[model samples]
Target: MPEKKQKKRPGGMDLDQKAYQGIRQMLFFNEILPGQKIKYQDLADKIGVSITPVIHALKRLEFKNVVSHAPNRGYFVNETSLKEITEIYDTRLLLEVSLVPEIIRHLDAESMDRLGKAFDAYREAVKEENYYNRLMTDMRFHLTIASMAQCQIQLKILQELFDTLLLKYTRNLILLGIMDSSLDEHVHIVKSLTDRDMDGLRQALSTHLDHVRNHITDGFRKMFAVKPRQMVDLFSLQ
Candidate 1:
């Protein structure tokens, strides 16, 4: 029906792309905070959709380890342990840095064209008022380059890291009012990749990851500093 077709997907997206956009936006903005209790029906209402689509979206998010279902408690955002986050970034630095050569070697005219378009979309997202769109566009641009390289295993690693680290960094960036910087980093990474500057790519990726790691680390410290100090007396007994 025309009415069904016209229905906006959760997160202000068209019905066809609604589910994808909804999850992508949610992850990108860290809208679903870590350890926050979530109910499917409630999330559905918040997004202005139904429980069916939300369930579908949550299933997809589970693959990325972004959300988990607990018996009796329903669904909730996954908490990222500091140690786990460190391990994720370590693997990311190793896997993605190794991807530079493969991507450069397989680089072709058409692939570069597609990369350019994705990068442009990221730029447009930055200019737009929609934070959700900016996040989705940013992911599209990076994933496009990764796909062009055609490395399945590496793609999996990047995908995992993207889900794990995105919220941590996204939340920090938002708190710092530097959401635009996230978009800028995507453009910088794409530029390095487009130029076939392996060294540039290496440096870009390193800086990008380092910035993310620092952001999360700093955020954790800021958020939990007082709570950790509260444990000092308990640790003193040991």
Candidate 2:
């Protein structure tokens, strides 16, 4: 564990909310990895809270499918699932692509500025050492584009899918290797949007998403390619 100073509770938030944020930060930074057991007391100590709140926070994470609990064991960071990820990727592809038209419809100076900032953020994040920051900024790049569409329900669903992808599967992202191409892809997206080329924007979105989906699929294949007994032992730990 990194030496973290005691965290004060943020305004208007309960102990559980504070603990939740603290734990989630740790999760994002890979201070803990997928399938690793969570120590409630350790988390409570680190977050400067009581175990009660940490446990409560964990239950909420469970509802979000961010962690899993095994009988007689304890809470563990969520293990990635090929089935779940496929569903999320497919859904995200459809939602994001569909939103492109609305985004083009609403294109304006403010939206362009937001997209530029999002791209700039992703570029800087990629330059940094932290993989989590890169993932977050990348998510922001996509979400910024989608938000301009102004489709409330679809946007909410897209956010949920993004949350699942980030929190649940990110620990294993190393298996997918460096996604350095996404920066260039992002540039393509921004350019297309800026030019108001609907076809170009759709292609950019589809191509970028397909590339990521392919990487994830290959990574999962590598993970599951182990011998049958070994694969069972692997999941048994989670």
Candidate 3:
């Protein structure tokens, strides 16, 4: 008698999250370079899955405008354009600043202390030159505060912005690379929150957003100086 063949087990991810994870992983690791052509079947093969999952993933990316389909040209990875990044940062600043009052009302002494610990970890990650670790911890600190606001919709929006920025930030930029003072900014934000200083929170958030915008602009300029085509200004094209 022939031996019975074992059935292949399904992947651990649910369909939607699996698609999200696949796209996110590709974007984060720089596997899918900007301006690269995207073929659904090819992507399916590359990811070692089927065309169904790949198409689903591409649709999600398209909704995010991370991928675009040109007539008869299949799909293409959207470049991290100047206008898109600026808009993302601006929207994020507005959302975060508006949440300051709500956050102040919700945070207690213990939550503030927890945020402090997260900031400490971020500082250590920066000192050790663990770039990704520092980036994640900084996100953690912000999300902790965002959570205190008790707004689920805002939390979801914030996560999307954070993911988009993290994907784009992997590229080299002088302002960000040279001045890693994110921890300092976090300290100020936490202090304002602790003291229930709404004005201070507003100021701190504004300063932080300005710093981020400057860094992004400076980094892209530097990157473009090295390679002219690496930078994209989407609004200029429009």
Question: Which predicted model would earn the best lDDT?
Answer: 2
Off by over 4 Å in 2: 1-10, 126-130, 174-177, 226-238
Candidate 2 vs. true structure, TM-score: 0.82
Better of 2 and 3 by lDDT: 2
Write one digit per residue (lDDT tens) for candidate 1, span 1-238.
Answer: 4655456634666543565456667766556677877676766766666777777777777776778888887778887566776677677667777788888888899999998898888788677755556655766776787777789988987886776666545553334323435766776787887688989988887777677666656665655554646534533442
The ten-residue window of minimal lDDT in model 2 covers: 169-178
lDDT of 3 by residue, 1-238 (tens): 9995522338556554565577678877777778889777776766666777777778778887778889888878887677777787788888988888888888787777877788788788878977667667877887888887888899899999887776655543212444557768877887788788989989998898789777877666665565445344521231
Residue 147 Cα positional deviation in candidate 1, in Å, after optimal superposition = 1.8
Collision pairs in model 1: none
Candidate ranking under lDDT, highest first, comes to 2, 3, 1
lDDT of candidate 3 at residue 13, scale 0 to 100: 60
The candidate, 1 or 3, that scores higher on TM-score is 3
Whole-model Cα lDDT of every candidate shown, in order: 0.69, 0.84, 0.73
As a whole number from 0 to 100, the lDDT of residue 160 in candidate 1 is 69
